[model samples]
Target: MEQFEAFLAAHLPSAASFHPHYETSLHQMLLGGGKRFRPALLLGVVQAYNTLLVPSAYHAALAIELLHTYSLIHDDLPAMDNADLRRGMPTLHKMYNEVSAILAGDALNTYAFEVLSNAPFSDKVIVKLVRSLAHNGGVEGMVLGQAIDCHFENQRLELEQVKMLHIHKTGKLIAASLQMGAYIVGRDDLAQQLYDFGIDLGLLFQIQDDILDVTQDETQAGKTTNNDEAKNSFVTLLGYERAMDEANALAEKVTRQMMSFDENLQRELSPTLTQYINRHKD
Candidate 1:
């Protein structure tokens, strides 16, 4: 994680020369600090396959983090979730202006591809990574999920429908993160298994997020609480206890699947995956 941070600190565009405010906004949001869950998942998969991190893997990790940060910025805009806080700080649109926030997000989104395209991997590997990321982060994945979410505002979604929404919105990119890692290490054979694990992990993560929205305060959650009141969420649709049960069930299933992997792989990944699942418990 420190290495990933250092890599981003060095590579992130400097706001000093051009649009310092815009660049600073980007840096603030990107460096504001979250769990770095997505990149960790990517790097963890690579480390599991090969005991060391590769240059291409680091590039891929940065790409994922950039894309994730972009999503957060946009998701907080007035036109979207109208969120005011992220990572326990004022959101981009709130800190800077909406225009800055939007342009910064756009820059991050495009720059992610640039980083991936210029990775130190072979052309074939880079192409696969780019394709996976585009598919997962673009219309076929997160965007589709966001569209569904916005379209269904104030409309109740069934449990299965909610699962589908999250699978696209929150799960696909996460699944792609694991898949990208497997590709980096030439472990495409593990792609399906890793993606499946990511599905459960993503769902668990979202469910816990939902739980936190209702239970934790801003200080503990590091973001606005009760923000999902108007949105379709696990806690909103299923009630607190049922949502928690679902999360626990998913966690159990994911843990079992992780155990099915080689012991070394399980040891490498369980800690990070466990922290993701148990975050709400804190």
Candidate 2:
């Protein structure tokens, strides 16, 4: 874990040059940290197929993590979710101020693509990486999902609507992580299965998050909890029991897909994935 954290820190942009404060704001937010789940997932997918880790693999993983961090930073803004905490610390906006947080998010979001484009990989692989990321993180995916969330905030949503929202906001990036890994390794068959697997895994993750919001502590979650009651969420639409049931079922179903892969891969990835699903922030 320390090695991985160091690996990412080494690749992350330095808080230097023209806008000193903007760079500092982004560094603080990105460096403040979370589970680094997306990057680890990307590495996991790569490991499942390749015997050796390529240098580009780490770069690709860092890019996804940067994008994820960008979303979290902005999500905590007053204009967005108005979150006060993130990763168990005062939010970027709260620590740095609103303008810095917004600029930091924007910088990280764009810098993610820059990292992807500049990664030390073949042109073909680079193209695939950029295309896969843009499709998943762009208007049709995460962005669209966030739009739905903002539009439907504080309103009761149908079950399908809630599912769609989570899929776009969380699932797309998870799926993209898998896809990016496959692109890096030049593997297509496993990529397709892993992509599908990631979608189910992501859905389970979001449901678990909703469950945590109701059942977990804000301190443990490192962010606001119980926001689902005031926003469009699966728990609000499906109720606690049913939402939990769905999360369990999805985890089981996705884990079953592991049969298509080796026992070793399944054995290593399944427990971590399940732990994430079953987690209670409290």
- Compare the candidates by lDDT and give the number of the best one: 1
- Give per-residue CA lDDT, model 2, range 1-282, as digits (tens): 466678777877766678647667777767787877777777776776674764558878888888988888888889888988888888888887898888888888888988888888889889888887888887888888988999888788888888899899999999999888877877876777878888887888888888888887888778888766678877788888888788778867876776666875675466457557557333
Work out the TM-score per prediction: 0.96, 0.93
Clash list (residue pairs), candidate 1: none
Residue-level lDDT tens digits of model 1 in 146-240:
99998898999999999999999999999999899999999889888888888888888888889989998889878878989779999999999
Error of 2 at 100 (Å): 0.7
Provide the global lDDT of candidate 1 against the true structure.
0.87
Model 2, runs deviating above 4 Å: 15-20, 280-282
Clashing pairs in 2: none
lDDT of each: 0.87, 0.80
